[model samples]
Target: MLVYFRLLSESFRFAMNALRNNKLRTLLSLLGVTIGIFSIIAVLAAVDSLDKKITKDLSSLDKNTIYLMKMSFGPSEIPQWKREQFPNVKYDEYLYLKGAMTNTDQMGYQIFTKSESLKYGSNTVTSVNVVPVSHEFIDIQGLEFDEGRFYTESEANSAAPVVVIGNEIAKSLFEDSEPIGKKIRMYGQRFTVIGVLKKQGSGMFGNDDSSAFIPVNFVRQQFGDNNKGLVNVIIFKPEKGVDMDAYKAEISQKLRAFRGVKSGEIDNFFINVFSGFTDFIDGIISQMNVVGWIISGFSLLVGGFGIANIMFVSVKERTNLIGIQKSLGAKNRFILFQFLFEAIILSVIGGIIGLLLVWIIAMILTKALDFEFVLGMGNILLGTGLAAIIGLISGILPAISAAKLDPVEAIRTGM
Candidate 1:
């Protein structure tokens, strides 16, 4: 064990000497490994950050939540023209489903509208996301409040002129002052702020921090119930541990009966499950992983070749040293390990530099974009392990050749 340690120490010194003596050659050799590590780790970090953001954004809502709407969230067998012709989900259907559905825990009606500006006195914030939803939306979405409270059921039903703003919107409009009970103008009407959502940062779909929520009845009243552009959706949260297939079947049966659809005809509305959407996202992430591996694999291959080339040159340079060591009764294993350790040290150093670069860039991006970019321990371990493996594979043949050299022939040739 002590001899092995001495071998490692000597190999490390030799590796440092190579770097000090041949600066440009060593740098050129290390560049491939550095770039290879950077590309792979950067791609992985970005993907992981994206996956985390998606998960965080959807964390409040249940995975079994279902959205019933005229349009499909994912691809559907229903033709686009037919889907377009389908009538929007009605408030009556929302009410009927809420009362009749047995497998549901919470259900609500919501309308996703285009961007609208809000005015507080002379201060105006433009292009803010406007969400008009029923009182039950709060429960269905599991929304957290920073101040005050969501509008009451009576308030939602009566089309009350009250609104709940996000943390960013509140800060933008009110500055240091309290936002609750302050009236803001939207759609050319005054609405009293009732609640403020907690700071949620940037989201996958949109920034929840800069959005406003109001009663769906208010939107219906303002635009009239039959507006063609308005997309009304009914959201349902299924009970935990329930059979999803049976729950979906029950919903389909109930809606089909309510809509008076006859046998053999396709259902007009689409039922989109949240879990299905997440699964689709997972598939996309998996494709990204495959692409990253393929693209970065080339870089790693070039790096491996560069290391192999350097190891061969190192063996040629150290021919006399190996001959002297063997003449002093050093074993074949010692000679082989000396060269292998040098190769590994060089590769690992390059990889460390690459990882450092990634960490710095990740920090800069996280601050610049206000999105968290993480470099987890697992990825770090994987990068280091890959570097070592590359070095070992590249060093083997050169190490073997150096170990086999006849001491007399090697010494004579070097002289």
Candidate 2:
């Protein structure tokens, strides 16, 4: 055991000597592995962070939540003109579905509107995401409060001029002073602030930090049902464990009958389920992972070649040393292991540097951006293992060739 330990120690010293002697060459050789490791781990960390954020944002909400609207969230066989001709889902339909649909848990009415600006006294916040939703949205979205409360059902129904601000919005508009009961201006009208949502970091779709919620009735009041610019959507949450297909079919039948569509004709509107949207997002994420591996794989390949190149050069330079060692009765396995250890050590060192870079960048990004970049332990282990494997593969042939050299011939060739 001690003999093997000494051999390993000797190999390590040789590896360190090579790195110390050829600083620039070592750096250049390791650069490929460094970049490859960085690329791979960085991509994985980013995707993981994004996936985690998406999960956090959607955790409270049910995956089965459905969005009923004229526009399809994903691909559709229906033509553009036909989709355009489809009427905007009306507020009445939202009510109808609430009463008519079975296996429903909760329903909400919302509108897709452009970003709006809000003003409080001299302070103004621009590009604020305006969420015009009914009172039920609070329950549907499982919204939690920071300071105040969501508007009452009567307040929403009566189109009361009230708004629920987000944490960032409250900070921007009110600073330390109380925000609830303060009046803010939007659409040339003053609205009393009612609630402030808890601070949530950036998400895959969007964040709640800069969002504001007003009653859907407020937008409906602004632009009546016939307004072309207004986009209305109906959200339905089905009861848990219900037959989704039948539930959707019932919705389709009722909506079709209401729209007066003839038999055998396609339904004009779309019933987009939230699970499908998430599934689409998952597919995109998977494709990104594949692309990252392919691109980073080239770097790893180049890195492997670099390791091999450096080992070959090392063997040539150390020919006399190997001859002397062999003449002194050193075993063939010892020479092979010496070179192998050097290759692996070099690769591992490069991988460690790459991992450090990733950690540094992740910290900076977590602070710089709303998104968090996480470098988990599993990924670290994977990177280290990959580096070691690359080293083994690159070092084998050179190690074998060196082990086979006859001492007499090698010594003569070196002289």
Tens digit of lDDT per residue, candidate 2, span 1-415?
8877887788788778888999899889999999999999999888888888888878887989899999998989999998999999999888888888888889899998888999999999999999999999998998889988999899999999999988999999999999989999999999999899999766667778999999999999898887888788999999999988888899999998888899999998999999999898888888998999999999999999999999998998888888998999989998999889889988988898899999999999889986778999989998999899989999998898888888988888889
Per-model TM-score versus the true fold:
0.95, 0.96
Residue pairs in candidate 1 whose N, alpha carbon or C atoms collide under 3 angstroms: none
Tell me the deviation in Å of residue 21 in model 1. 1.3
CA lDDT of each prediction against the hidden true structure: 0.90, 0.90
